[model samples]
Target chain A: MEMKKTILNPEGLHARPAGQLAKVATSFKSKIEVIFNQKTVNAKSAMSLMTLGIIQSSEVIIKADGPDAEEAIQKIATLIDNHFSV
Target chain B: MSLKIIGQKAAPGMVHGPIFIFKKGNSEINRSHHLFSDFDPSKETLLFEKALYKSLQDLENLKNKFTSIDKEKIDIIEVHQSLIDDPEVKEQTLAKINHENKFAYVAYEEVISLFKNMFSEIEDSYLKQRVLDLEDISNRVLFYIINPELNFSYFSYSQLNDSRPSIIISEDLTPSDILGFEKTKVLGFVLSKGSPQSHSSILARSMEIPCLVGAHELETLDLSKYTDLILDTENSEVILNPNINEVKSFEEKVSLFKFKQKQLFSFKGKKTETKMGKLVPLGANISGPLDIDSVIKNDAEFIGLYRTEFLFLDRITPPSEEEQYETYRTVFQYLGHKRIIIRTLDIGGDKEAPYIRIQKEENPFLGVRGIRLCLKEIELFKTQLRAILRASNFCNDLGIMFPMVSTISEIKEAKKIFNTVKTELEQSKIQIGKKINIGVMMEVPSLAWILKEVSDEVTFISIGTNDLFQYSNACDRMNNQLQTISSPTHEGFQRFLKFIVQEAKKNQLHVGVCGSIAHHPEIMPYLISIGVDELSMTAQNILTVRAQIADL
Candidate 1:
């Protein structure tokens, strides 16, 4: 399953939010990856996500594969919607 | 040949010392690693995983042990922790160990360098900063992998063995990395990559260590060729392998700077009185307890302006009464015997909290802010008042100041709320302090002319000159084009301030100037002569202001 979303954080996917996003990704029993600017990185790795340099309003495609793929994608999409405040 | 590198001054000082080229990671591992003839990928993989786990534990321990007053510092540690927890780094290192037949530590090092090189190419500075955090964790993990028994988590000066006074030159340093170095042995720092706003540079400034950041030319220099170095932050440059003449001139500058500092230190315990023997109390304007050390160091007579906005800003929710009370009590407890004047939430204008709902106006500075905002949000005002009144029990001399007060009615409304909170606390048998003074921040220009009208409502007035000057001239102080017109030394501004001070005196209201202009060398003498009762400034300016007062 995959879904597209735009980052709303003023600071983009910086350390704190990236860590938070990764923490949420790690919860589901699925392989999740974030694709930005044609570059795909493991969503469960904050360092890999940060390597994308995703800034505010950057569009990214989140892809998840496994039994819990749909749940994983939905959770990550919601996290981005909240500007990664959690 | 002497090499000169220009950079931004992170801190002010002058020093000459032997140059020490400090590298972050353990370089010994690179030399010791050899071509493995009979390689065991599984064993090496196991070792790598153990190192990673141990490194994570070390970071967790550090995070647990750290009790920093600044929440930002702890956030840095958490970032480092998450950086280590990245599955990509572990996966890449394990893959290298299993497939390429590399040593455990070597595989980890290669993986880290790959990420570091990738991050280095990034133009976004905030993302680029992660490279340093990457290095910090890599150093820790590598240290644990090689020398687990040593239990060395931080890079220390003892590793160098040579104890000669030196200026540390590095690619960049983390806050933890800088803290690990021996302060007495390090004369200064020259970083090839970093900004003055980096945590490391801020730490350097607070530590009073001379540092130059963003010295790109430093990366090109062959450090071994430069045995001696001169770090002159006043000029925002470092001279490596200085010539005989350069050394002599640097020595003279160092002594003169030292002499000036020594002279200022002598005025610490002395009375803040002018040559004419007119005494005035010099106080520090602090945001929170983090600045308490500096406040005591500079020998401030009192905390004239404690901006309480720090507690309100940068958080999603407003601080509860209990949290606010605890913070105020801690500050008051720390500054025992010394009088403390705390200003209520002075938000709006330049500072905006997302939690506080205010209409978006074209001009925020002229819109609802400070006391005006408080007046509208009665509950918010009362909660803060309740906290302050509760904390007053711990303080011998505490003053509650209302900011952005313009009209006499605003002052009356605020005091009325303050009295209601006080009575409520009293009815609950809360024993508040007796001699707590209520004051107003005289930032609104109109309030100055009407000081006498509101004299009975407020006990004291602290002139916030920055806003007063900006509002008086109708010029934005931050706009670079208006710099000349917004100058504090403008005759009208000076005369206006003099009038405010004179009015406060006539009303028997103790007045202090708690703004950038208080420490202005050209204006401090004039203010002293005009009978200003107190001049409040940042902790760093205390001694200099005291010295200036003595010379007046």
Candidate 2:
């Protein structure tokens, strides 16, 4: 399962948001990856998410593969869509 | 031979000490040697984990230390902790050690550098600055990894157990760095780069530590060779390796300064009076309840100016009336019978509250601020008035003063609100003092001219010379460019003050000078000679001014 979302935080996908994304990804039993600027990185790695330079209003693709792939994609997509405030 | 390096004086005081130079980036880290001769991947990874854990613990301790007092500092420490705990950082560092055959320090540095470079390349300036935080964390971890037995702290001064006080010479001092240091153990500061307006310098000044900024060519000097140094901020000069004669002269000056300070201590509990027979009240201008100790130690007769704005600053929301009342009650309890003249909120201008939503202005000093702001924000102003009125029931000597009033109408409007608040409080069966004196801060030059009209409306006036001097000269006191013309000693400014004093006397109104100028020893006699009824300054200056007044 895959989902596309735009970064809504005015501060962009900085450390805090990336950390949140990683934390959420690790909680699910799915292999998740985020693709931005032609580079794909493990969604559970904050350093990789941050290095993508995903700034405000930028779009990224989230891909999840496993038994709970659909659920993982939904959760990760919602997190990014809400701009990681949670 | 003594080398005299001139710089801008950021804070005023004098001290002599051995120099402790702090160069950023911890350039002393030994990059030439690897942590292990032959790479053992698990061992190296364990070493990294140990250092990371230690660094995290140190940050946690710092966060706890600052948790109660400083919100901004706590947030910064938390960010550093999160970065250290970032799993990706740990994973990447271990991958380098296992695959690349690199040592622990080397692997950590390389991985951290990669992230730092990536952050720096970002278009956002704020994100770019985050690279400094990463660098700070990296330095802490790398320091621990290099010397496993030694403890790691970002600020070296905090860890030093040396008994001798030292002067700090640094490339730049951040607010957190200043906060981390044991202030009493640090005698002075000389920075190669900093502005007087920077938070570090402001903190240094408030802490009363001597500081000199923009000391060019400081970084190139062999710091080890010039261990003993003299920081003479009065002369804006730092003396390196002074000769016998220079040291003797410096010692003489130090003794004279110390002697004067000692003499002032004798006058602490003594009455401040002229040599003839004129008695004047010498008091302290305190910001909050915390300063009551200084007020008592200095034997202040009253709190001439209780600046209430300190409670309003550095918070997201305005203080509630109950909160303000509790603080005011504590202050009253501390002072007991000692009179307190509480100046209402003087926000805007240099001091701003984001929650208030004041419009940006080209010249805030001349814009809607002080009483003008209070008038516009009537509900906020009324809340404060009600709090003070309620708190007045706790003390016999409570006075309310409005700031930045330029017209009779502003005074009338403020007084009307005060009366309304008093009535509301009384109707609610709250016991309030009817003897609470109402006054105005004689800051705006226009107020000085209309002393008759002002005296008709109020019981007293406190001349806020800092603002009066700036407003009268049309020069920003904080602007370095206007240093020459912005002086309070300008003859024209003195004449204005003299005129205001005369007008107050004619109207039989109590008048006082409560400003930084009132703290100046030389200016003390001039203010006394001008017939000002009282002098209020920072509590630290009370004894000094009193001793000077005794001599006069």
Q: TM-score: which candidate is best?
A: 1
Q: What is the TM-score of chain A alone in each candidate?
A: 0.97, 0.95
List, residue by residue over A1-86, the lDDT tens digit for candidate 1. 88989987555776778898999999999999999999999999998888888776689999999999998888888888886756
DockQ of each: 0.25, 0.18
Q: List the residue pairs that clash in candidate 2.
A: none
Error of 2 at A61 (Å): 18
Q: Which ten residues in a row have the lowest lDDT in candidate 1 chain B?
A: B27-36
Model 2 chain B: ten consecutive residues of lowest lDDT: B66-75
lDDT string for model 1 (B281-366, tens) is 99999987667778888899999999999777654446667567777877777885799999998888556465577888788899
**Stretches > 4 Å off in candidate 1:** A1-86, B1-4, B25-28, B31-135, B146-163, B220-225, B274-277, B308-330, B345-394, B408-436, B474-487, B547-552
lDDT of each: 0.82, 0.80
The best candidate by DockQ is 1
